[model samples]
Target: MASDPNTAPHLFDRALLRARMDRARRAGPVAFLLDRVVEDMADRLQAVTRGFSDVAEIGSPGELLPWPLADRFASITRVDLDESETLPLEPESLDLALSALALQFVNDLPGVLTQIRRALRPDGLLLAAMVGGDTLTELRQSFAAAEAECEGGVSPRVAPFADLRDIGGLLQRAGLALPVTDVDRVVVRYDSAFALMADLRRMGATNILIERRRIPTRRATMLRMAQIYAERFADPDGRIRATFDIIWLSGWAPHDSQPKPLRPGSAKSSLEAAVKRAPK
Candidate 1:
């Protein structure tokens, strides 16, 4: 059954929705900045394909085609889920699935993965990239301090991120085989912490926790956060640095007739010996 938006596990809060709307309004500049990263990921995915008759791109529209890789796709469908439980596609239909910087917002990551796996045909490939735990250290620290001063305690400002190991495990749990995961850290420098927040907002990435309680942040808290951010994580040139850890994951659906290497006894010599004797 499709989960209700209100009752869904990964519901985005009002503050987060407002943030995303604000970011969407300024998508022009944000898209420009993120173009390079999107293009790189697309290129990598393209290289792995022999040919794809059907492809599905989740999340950002601009990420799919900075210039126009759409021509290469046989049937390209874009899926964007905001406050929804199920993907808007049939099961076992897609040949290739790609998502860049999109999965972090999902409240039910495992459920979402199940949907993706179901959407792919036998042997279909899924490649995704999402922001991971080490992202926005400076901003998180500042927010923690602000919460400590303004509120009695701090609630998580940014949503929790999945680690590489966890992501691989998620793929396995979702019934995806040959799952591989890796991380890439992109360090961005800004004139101030405010600029960093502005960039994130422009990228349609802001707080969207559905369970978040309303607590107005004081101006003093903001200022203190900025001060701490600058002092603690500033570069020698006095600019603030924010690190975005991008996690890359790829997997294939299991198939009954999939080829397998010889078993231990099937080979004359040990597997290690066979590998050593094979051509370099």
Candidate 2:
């Protein structure tokens, strides 16, 4: 059955609740991956400064902290849309900003990025990680197969994600400079679809597509979906793999730069010299 467009908000609420349940039930592996990324980020930040006097973490949900640096910083504040429509910080006051696995959920990403840029002091850095478009390929395929077998058609139900290629441009549009983005694909194998759904809940990553059906998903349909997922996507080892593409981004808040004329007595390097100087 096709989703009711009029019930977009209701569907989103239901999907959010389902995601919360999934996170509560299966959080171990997901937390493990999240922690590694946070630690890596924290280590880099620590190298730059002995401590930050003021820092804000957006959409953290009380998790994904690098606790080793907890004592190093003079103050740490957590910000979430659930708490406030606007960021709690004064404009251009934050020393650093960080987020992980959260940007994908925001409805107005550019607006949020603009807010982050506004909250940062000139040259302050923003680092964020979010799930990219290629996540959950196996689960999506299974869902499509189940719809085909039971309903004769599959209406789109998944939330769309930002592409890596376009992320840098978004940063530039938000008035952030020196943007960098990289993709990390993590493949996790599951013995059963039920277990996979459990993990998604624990990670607070249940689907919240605006056009999702409001009616309860029937047990029969769920089972059919699981079976189709296992049969079509399971590996020879009898486990199904879910691929999560995590995109990491870093950028500096905008700053004025003084342009200089070309050097009076310098010449461009030869193509051969440039090729030799590039990293092997």
Candidate 3:
């Protein structure tokens, strides 16, 4: 089914985004942020389990989930952003579906997630990460201030990121079993705000907001923004701080054999009695 146009805002230009990513790939390692995201995702995936018979990794680019996960899955199929948006998998065919630093751009996030749930075999798993939760607060603030000071207004520069509470709720709404979500926060240091922007460009993560300003930004305004960024977020060494929060979510497709939480009032021992039995 197509996404509801009334409620869903087209906030991103996805074709342009793909072009940006292609350019970034040609440039190579413009930003190390996604690399870190993929690395952490690999660790998380490894910690939970290993060795799946059939797996699909969606929306991961270049290096495709790091080298460590190569032999763990018997087969790994890669799907880009467009495929993930339209989830073209056979129902109940996949043993595992994984994505990294993606899915935040989808116009219909809930619908996409539900489709992913449907694609998984019963008891199959979905482990994914998206850049979110104050990921670029410093840059957002800097750009807003610069735009307001230079043009007396600010246009949308950073796409709004999803929150953990809403994300967990979405997992449940998608009918995922035993859903879990966690936020991983990391602070990276850059020599300057300009350097940070350069990296964002290389990452193909620069502003692709549909409502972004059409004209080029003024150099003087950009300089002022850089100054403000340094004054507000610079560290002891004068390097500016950038925050990236990778929200990780995982769930299993429902099956009769999987463990289920005890029903309310079905606990064998009471909390009060357990407390009483504890040593001082």
Candidate 4:
């Protein structure tokens, strides 16, 4: 059955994204961002004393996770990118699930997350990281300015990313408990805007929006974009800055062992009384 457009708005062209990823893999994937995220995931996992037996990793580039999880999980299943939406896993099969730097491209994030939640065992953990919140703001701004100047109008050049609060709500909507969200803002400097574009190409992170312009960007527009980027986002040292906000999200499947919130009207002390007891 066709998905309802209201619930599953198709923002990304998944086929194009897959092709780009294949091209990047053939050209030796430039995976600095993925590597960084994997390391952070490792550190976070260290804080949890419990061990996970059946774990699934989605969107992780080429063995980036195996090193950190070498002696850990009994089985590590790698979910293919094509199966991102369906997530071909049995219900309540996984003890842990993780995705790195990939969920942002999913067309139906809520549906995908619901699938993950269902696949997780009771009290199983779900940890993921995705780019969001002002990521590529410089490029988006530069392109908008340049396109408006050169083409009389602007087109969709960058993907819209979710914010921290939106992700937290998604976790709750997916029936995951104790939803926690955080951000890791990483600012990278490049010699020029063109250099940053090249890195994005190498990373296969170019615009694959469903409504993206089909024709090639005009040379004049490209040049003007570079000029505007330098003018607005470059530092005194002549390097342009790009911001990438990595939003980290973690939640657990509901279980009796987990703590539950108090009933709405079950508080012993009134708000006024609590305020009077506050440190002054």
lDDT of 2 by residue, 2-96 (tens): 12234322324434644574456555445755776787677767767534567889976446555777666677788875412345668888878
Model 2, position 47: C-alpha lDDT score: 68
RMSD of each: 3.9, 6.1, 2.4, 2.0
* Candidates ranked by TM-score: 4, 3, 1, 2
Q: Assess candidate 2 and give its TM-score to the true structure.
A: 0.80
- Give candidate 3 misplaced runs (Cα > 4 Å): 1-7, 65-68, 268-280
lDDT of each: 0.77, 0.74, 0.83, 0.90
Q: Which candidate, 1 or 2, would have the higher TM-score against the true structure?
A: 1
Encode model 3's per-residue lDDT on 1-280: one tens digit a residue: 3345456677788787888888888887564666777777777777865357788887766655557666777888887667236777888988899987778877678877888888889999999888888989999999899889988988888889998998998999888999999999989899999898888888889888888888988898889899999999999889999998889999999999889999999999999999999999
> What ranking of all candidate models by lDDT puts the best one first?
4, 3, 1, 2
How well does model 4 score by local distance difference test? 0.90
TM-score of candidate 1 to 2 decimals = 0.84
TM per model?
A: 0.84, 0.80, 0.90, 0.95
Error of 1 at 130 (Å): 1.2
Q: lDDT: which is higher, 3 or 4? A: 4
Location of the lowest summed lDDT over 10 successive residues in candidate 2? 1-10
Provide the lDDT at 27 for model 3.
88
Clashes of each: 6, 5, 0, 0
Pull out the clashing pairs in model 1: 10-107, 13-208, 13-209, 13-210, 16-207, 16-208
